[model samples]
Target chain A: MIKGGFAGRILHVNLSEQRTWTEPVDDALARDYVGGLGICIKLASDLIPRGVEPLSPESVFVLGVGPLVGTDLPSSSRMYAVARLPASGTVGWCGAGGYTFGAQLKYAGYDHIIVSGMADKPVYINIEDARVDIRDAGAMWGLGIDDTCESVYRDLDAQAGVIAIGQAGENKSAIAMAFVDRISTLGRGGFGAVMGAKNLKAIVVQGSGGITVSDRKRFNKLSRSLLNSFREYKYLKEWQELGMLKAFPMVPIDVYKRMKERRTACVSCPVGCKEVVRIPDGPFAGLVKHTSSALNLFTPMMYGMQDPWEAVKLITDLDSYGMDMFEFFGLMGMARELAGSGVISLTPEEPEIDLTSFSSMSAWAERIARRQGTGDLLADGFSAVLEKLGNEAKQHAPALIKGIHPYAGPGAALPWDRFGTMELGQVLDPRGPHVGSGGSPTYFAIRPLEVFPKHLKRMGIPENVVDRILGPDRNKLHVGRLLRYSHAWFAMLGSLGICARGQVNRFYNADLCAKAYEAATGIPTSTDDLRKRVDRVWTTFRELNIREGLDASKEALPDQWFRESGFKEYLTGEPLSKKQAEEMKKEYFDEWGWEG
Target chain B: MKYEITYIQENCSGCLRCQLACSRAYARSFQPSAACIKIESRGAEYRIIFTKDCVECGFCADNCLFGALTKTPKEVTA
Candidate 1:
């Protein structure tokens, strides 16, 4: 049995029956699955019925926190939401980080909350320590995420953790998302639609209990050492000031200097990566928006919106509607193309498809969120929309996997010339395109091939596996083989509720993570043991997806990626070919022991 | 010489590490409400408050990386 860290219980809530029950976390389950997305996958795989409609009452939604959460560990504020997502029709996990939500849920005496069944009317879950109530949320039903959270805070406490969906979710839009504390986004693949189908408006939690560690002395000492390292780091000040803008430089320095109000960090985190910005002087003067990172603020620049104030306003409107910005843009881009080519026609009542005009885009966002007129068809996402418009329209659709848009690769949003772990991950991951790099060396930057062995070793890749990844020449790096280890590393971080962002994960290695886990839970763990456990977790995740009918056949790089010139391999820098891409997928499937 | 915690509310990024450290040191668990230090959120700003049970152990101050808290010797009196 585990000695500490976990809250030691799981809370099951059935909205249809308005019933709640507590189940003791099984020791065997905890030992095998670990926590966070690990346990989430296990529970989802077992409970969600085969071929269950993602929006049906039978679909299960699991929110899980790892043992390290609610502790003094830096950036241990992440939580995972596992559900059969409507966007992809696959059971997927989406993680978000902030203060209160994960930690408070744990302190409220639950490591996981498994929500099932649909309510007859609009309702919200109120969790106050041991008191769990399904309260009426009729008044909050049509409200935006910001207003819903405010209403909950007003009725309860301002410090209460809240996860709420907006109008887009209520309308069951395929691109809908939910927000944590109205800042960090919870779901990406239309998990909000699932919540809407269940009539769950929000979840407010006020936890008074505390989280205890088995070895306090060791945990405290390790925390202190980690904090001291940050204090002495040369870039702490600059990082705190610029956040992600320092690395990406997506936003202009002048605009950032003028608008940035302050930086915020997740629970126990010293690196304040989140930004709170206010419009300094513009048409939307005095407007304030809290973004997960500075990277979000630059999203409009990709669509030709140059004015920062206008961009912020557009982003605010979309966020208020609870829409996935990436999906919305991708769908709108396709819609415009289809209309221009005579494959589809926009009704007179519908707004014009103008990417540059803020008013036009804002109108589209509102219509889509409310599912009005043409928005009804657009709200169902690319695959559904294309299926209605026939093959001619499908030809104009952008490269997509699992019925969702790919955010990176050639001719995509963040175009890159070379394949990396994330590039491969976008194709391989069942959840579709995401930014979870899993601490890969090829995440966002090009690195020297000679240093890959050290990076691989740091991720706890076994020597034999490293040899396999490096191949016979001991020089060429097989991205697919390395992706398997990256997935394992990602599982380890996600299971522990640690931030997998490059800035934070760089401070951690597999050895340190094992020590931290052992110290937190008093469960004896070695680097190899931790690696093996995480590998199991990743394998289970893949197996669950396989059960959902996702296999090597479903995996495909965008055809446009190869058609476009200049794209090359990360290690060899050689031109990419369709045959080479297939080989990568084969290598990945072989490494996972899923070869035919 | 007596030491006291000097708090600068503006410097706090609201990570709540101070509260976690204080609670862990005193209550043997990680609970923000149980901590001597409290970070109250006022919109985008933060207000730090210390409860009467605080022994001025400096754990919160030591753990704060944003210069929000610091332990210093008390001012000498005439």
Candidate 2:
């Protein structure tokens, strides 16, 4: 028996051979990799052979939950899905929330599930305890995410948790996502498209087994105190109703208040950040929806829809089709700018190339999902479109860092206030560019500078280090040390299946998570120990990327985005200089002990 | 003092931290179904149900993260 908080089993399914088996999880592997993102990445690095196409049968997809999953610990419902993804052709990982998929997977007696090979036809996997079935999904193919989820759940148990892809994935769109419970997503990195390539439609799970801890009493005590702390958290009520909607400073609070009908939360989430809204009366009257993220709401805004409700509809429609809004916006933005500049001509079959009209955007979204006309060229992602368009059309390509749209860069609509490190974090992330990878600096961006010391201390940073960093000569926003800490912190969170959403996990830190892990698993860990483990996982991840021929030197925002445009730095209000950016990159790499 | 545990259904976020706490106190296992207090989803809303087997131990109340459950004294008959 492997102590506690682990199921001690990993299920392996080979689609090509139609075989299923379970392996006893090695204790040393579990200790070294930790769990979730760390373990999934480590496994993919070991099992997946290089020089093979990402969508090939040999490419492995791993979904894993950590030891903290299924417990009452705050934000313990998160999971990570990883693959040598088609999105950036890098070993990338995406963290998911808003359901009990991770918990159910754990309760079903699995630490992780690896799907290899490819099915001759469309299929889905069903897991209930020791029983695992590979069923034909011929009827479910080409269905929308909602329809796919309902169909699987209706045939199986109503309480069964699902991770399904939609028409986007069926068509193998590089921007496709895996929708979990129809409300949350394993967003970015295009793992869903890999699922499509493997002819896998969905994975349905249900379990009634209980997870036992090493020290039940101590674990219960830790959980109880954490719960009590949440009661005292000031923003709990607002977060319960609005989700991350509350955190967005740009959106008028009244707009969300008018639309919100009810609160629907992820499994085992006390914060209840997810919302269900009903449009009162308009062209889109009585449209009840549980889908809408900051990206979804803002993507339509980029298309010039003034109303938040219209944006809501666009997001809902996009989610149903299982698309990545980040990539879609980049495609649309580039298409509009290029067409208007007379560099490219959109064919007549393409939805009228009006980038600003909601109707045009919606029509275009459908075309992309269906792979019709010009939409077919753009559906695969920014890089593919550039390649298809040839040399002249490459001039019109959107500024994509590492061939993936930036979730936090100038490409996005939301005004992200970062203390410089977010940019480094985005560029350095293995999965091209992402907003959430860098750390929890959004809190630092918004909160008062006086509280920096307290926050650092709470995050388990030693007082001497904190004092040296925040000394009189040092600028308050100077974040070199903080950036280093943030990477390790988030990596650790992913390993432990902890959700690091700013609103829900504002007060969370390595110390608290370490305590919880020790109590439940009898692992006897500390904040320093977790940080070191995070460093190990991150280094191994980098080594894997290097082996796959990824060039670390070219990892940066494109020159045109910086030099061609005179955009002011977010904090300094001065135009960002190339020289300054280069210096920052060098400093960042030095801090992480990486070669420039 | 004799007390009654009142369930405020609206305040629950369906996190089930309370149920886990209760199960730990009563069942010695981390099973939500074994707890005295049950949180059920009625459409988008959550309803808190107290079982007859509940000992009024107040463990659930103490761990109600969102203040969805509270324990108060049972009023004496005049």
Candidate 3:
């Protein structure tokens, strides 16, 4: 069948066997699930043996590139990867933006790639056009992501898309990530450990050619429209200047303060949200730049510890060593608690509970990465050390999110009436609340029907009309309609490979996207069809997660969400209450066809 | 041809978009395992220097947000 976008082939690389193959993608799959989430899940489902060990050789490593990538569409050059998490036993994946992403992959005559099993020796997989190589990465191991990429480039004749892990993944520590282009990452749920478990050092692919689209005229028109909208949108300016790390300081307002400035999105992203900062004086004193890392970890830690750049550098160092930033900090919480309570005393140059020296903190970060002295306890991870510390650690562990040390304090952003009942719904059914958006009705559709008290309780919104959020159908209120619309949106984008929502979703109008895709590939499409592609992609991911144990019962706001965190929103002293989230979760679940 | 960059090793973040783009523009697939652009980290110096046989394409410089990779006029595409 003719298509507007998509390269139409799926690439499979088997590390254990050191073999690669190409399979034509079915149009039906594209229409239904979209690309990243849908395609990867379905792809993973075929080979995932039930109850497979995450870090074992049998694990599946998956990558997906969509059709809408490249083509100069705002935030469009991105790809998604998913697989069994070596640590959390939950679905794991990350998305990245780069020039090579789908464009290069499509030029190589494939839409996506999935790697399975493990390599017996230290090796890296190289994909160049039709050629493939499993070369040694012996010197690359133990090196940071930066070093690894440099070494790979030195040895290769052609340029390649590189996804590699630092020492943390090599250790299979269960929280490492596949670093992309040294600026973005596929981090979450600890599958970097799975890659390490496979002894597969990295995967690189490069293709040079062209992809043909179904129609060109329509594509051009749409892309132009999107570009113009992007130019006019306020957020696009922010993205172009900052990238994806916008509001870096705001994220940690509840804890940290050293976010020097907000910056722009990643390469090819017009929305510049990432920021760069330099530690004024400390062991890590100097320069450091991060997109999400600066915002997510550095910002929070700075506020909590009253040190910004130092905190960011500490995490960056951990990232270099491939340590899970979450784990690093979570373990620190334990360490800090231990020290403050006198469970452990400062070991020489070590920090005592009273130390404010950032250099000591910087040294402490290195020590943790090197697994020196008590740092080894942290390197062992929170789950183990908490167990070793027994009661106090265990008591504090719940304060952590999913065994992670919570930074924003007890009570995160959840609702009470909706808490157990709501998130429990996402847990029970796998697709989650379909969040990421501040709030989407699809989430409302899937959650428990809004009862008056619960609705009033959770909807704590002072301004929102109760009925608007509660929806007219005490139970059904157009969730299916919204979902269908969402499906179309994802399907359209998936088919086009346009996953740049985070940085420029607010900036680009649909028409510009259409024009870019068309201009690049000569494919012609419409806004309506484009939406279908987006929906298709989202559904595919949702379904994939479902197949991978995403169900209504398994989803819920973390327990801490319902309880009030001791801290309040940084800018607003107004306390965040979970009562509304709990109520919303049920309404969200029901709207999405989730029943618990 | 040479490429200039503001990338301090610690700032690399190890995302590899530069490598991916270099590989794809010159070679065509999104594989950075073999890109011409390389970022080398000097631990003691606290820097990540981008190294590559210069194609002199202004992609990195044009795309740099932090002035990490400053592009010369000759490298910019029309």
Q: Going through the candidates in order, what is the number of backbone clashes in each?
A: 0, 1, 169
User: In model 2, which regions exceed 4 Å deviation?
Assistant: A156-158, A292-295, A341-344, A417-419, A442-448, A460-472, A476-481, A560-571, B1-12, B36-58, B66-71, B75-78
- Scored against the true structure, residue A309 in model 3 reaches a CA lDDT of 56
**lDDT per residue, candidate 1, A1-596, as tens digits?**
68898999999999999999999989888888888889998898899888899999998899988999999888888889899888888788888884678888988899999999999999999999999999999999999988887777776544788889999999899899988888888888898899999999999888889999888888888878887888888988988889998878887788888998888888888987887889889789998887788678668777887787888889888888899998998998998998899887889988788877788888999999999888889999987898898889988898888889987777666766788778878888877777583348887556877778887888888788888988766777788888878888889999999988878877788998899889888788899888888888888887888888886556777787788574588876787887887788788878888763
Error of 2 at B52 (Å): 5.6
Error of 1 at A550 (Å): 1.2
Give the least accurate 10-residue stretch of model 1 chain B, judged by summed lDDT. Answer: B1-10
Instruction: Decide which is better by TM-score, 1 or 2.
Output: 1
Instruction: Point to the candidate with the largest TM-score.
Output: 1
State residue A440's C-alpha deviation in candidate 3, in Å. Answer: 5.8
- Choose the strongest candidate by DockQ: 1
In the predicted model 1, the residue pairs found to clash are none
Ten-residue segment with the worst summed lDDT in candidate 1 chain A? Answer: A437-446
In terms of docking quality, model 3 is incorrect
Chain A TM-score for each candidate, in the given order?
0.97, 0.94, 0.76
Error of 2 at A60 (Å): 0.6
Cα deviation in Å at residue A363, candidate 1? 0.9
TM-score of chain B in each prediction: 0.88, 0.85, 0.57
Better of 1 and 3 by DockQ: 1
Error of 2 at A136 (Å): 1.9
